[model samples]
Target: MKVTRYTKADAEQWDAFVRASKNGTFLLQRAYMDYHSDRFADHSLIFHDDKGHPVALLPANERDGVLQSHGGLTYGGIICDESMTTPRMLEVFDVLLEHLRTNGLNRLLYKTIPYIYHLNPAEEDRYALFRADARLYRRDVLSVICQDRRLPFQKRRARKVSQAQKLGLVIEASEDLEAFWAILEANLAAVHGVRPVHSVEEMRLLNSRFPDQIRLHVCKENGGIVAGVVVFNATRVAHVQYISSSERGREIGALDLLFATLIERDYADQAYFDFGISNEQEGKVMNVGLIEQKEGFGARAVTHDYYELSVV
Candidate 1:
């Protein structure tokens, strides 16, 4: 086996491999990862077999002598295709550790992709991590609804949706990012006292690049946007990347209406509806109110774990 650093010249090859990888997402693609290239020192890796055929890839970055699978993405680790086996992954990690140590990196942080995102059964990396004596550093709870056997929404949530319907709120696809950004900015600031991770311009650029994968859905009242969500469609999973509501929207339960329509109509065919994470402070703190709201919609927990491995 052999390992090599990723380069601009390998962009096409990298994207092709990601598309075929069992647990890979579009987020790992070069176009997406490089959106904020000025921010991180990328040190992604590509692994190949003795015959020189590409076998696996790692979307990662290096900072202060520590290599992170990818600090910018929701999850990142070894991405491989169906051909990858437990032994092969172990070998890959062995070579990967050697490469990192040779480059003077003393530690590595790995984020495991949640199972809901997998196109096939691909958990060999977890076993490999255990074999490598990696420590569990963090574990976040993701609220998700299994579309095939979805649970009924709680009575209060159902009532809210009914009330929203009675108010004649319109749920539809939207192109008004500026308007939604205004609502998102205000909502995040008022609730968390922080701004959005992505600015309007950056989101617009990403949406334009991934037209089909990225979408905006809004609940409107009297021709004005009241609430909205940015869904990142990743094959089987419809992930809510951003969700927010205006004051009036909340009063009238616009979010309940929007989510009901999205889950039942827009993305009903998808396998799962992921509401992202509800943990804070590296999973030590649980936001009960935030998670309860998601749970009201019949969502349950799926964990996203982070692991640390010593390179020395």
Candidate 2:
């Protein structure tokens, strides 16, 4: 395979290839990746087969001589199609490392696309990572619900949902960013002491670009937003990208009601529903209370891993 450095001229082909990739999500698309291009030194690459047909794409960025695939996204690696066999993956890695070394990059940080996101069996990169002697640096666990064979929601969560229902909250899909972001920002500041990854303007722009893929669902009380979640919809998974609740919302279990509506009514048809990550500090610590709340909704664990590879 011939490895080619990505260029703006390659955007069309790059996006087409990602659409056809086994594990590709809209997050891997140029439309999504380029939204914050100004913040990252993009070092993405495209691989062409012997006949000059594209085989894979690496969505990556370079920082301080280390290449992350990619620092901007939650998870990314070699985005390949069904043609990616184990031996072929090894060849790709060999070429990838050589390309990195030749380009003066000494280390590569690879973030894996979790299995639940795969359109087909796509674990060849894992086997190849073992061959390359990559080190596991981080592992974040996401709470996921398998739709068809879902486990029953814990009684505790059920009770909360019931309580929330008694409050007469309205749950609906919305385009209201101001109300939701206000609640989200305040909640994050008070509880986590951090801010949302995307600014209100940035999120609005993204929503406009991919309205169907990115959605906002709000739980409101008397036309005022109390709790909300931003869900990123993919072929097999509907991932909760952001979630927050106001003090009033929490007291009445507003989030529980919102999630119950999503899991049972809104996204019941999806194969998996991902409740983002619970681990912090580069996966060293688990937030027990947060994860237990997700588990109460019958969501189980799915790990997203990061590997460090020596390219020198």
Candidate maximizing lDDT: 1
RMSD of each: 0.7, 0.8
Lowest-sum lDDT 10-residue window in model 2 = 86-95
Report how far residue 163 has shifted in candidate 2, in Å.
1.6
Query: Candidate 1, which segments miss by more than 4 Å at Cα?
Result: none
What would the per-residue lDDT of candidate 2 be over residues 165-185, giving only the tens digit for each residue?
998899999999988999989
In model 1, which range of ten residues has the least summed lDDT? 70-79
| Estimated TM-score for each candidate | 0.99, 0.98
Candidate 2 wrongly placed segments (more than 4 Å): none
lDDT scores of the candidates, listed in order: 0.94, 0.92
Question: Which whole-number lDDT from 0 to 100 does residue 302 have in model 1?
Answer: 99
Error of model 1, residue 229, in angstroms? 0.4
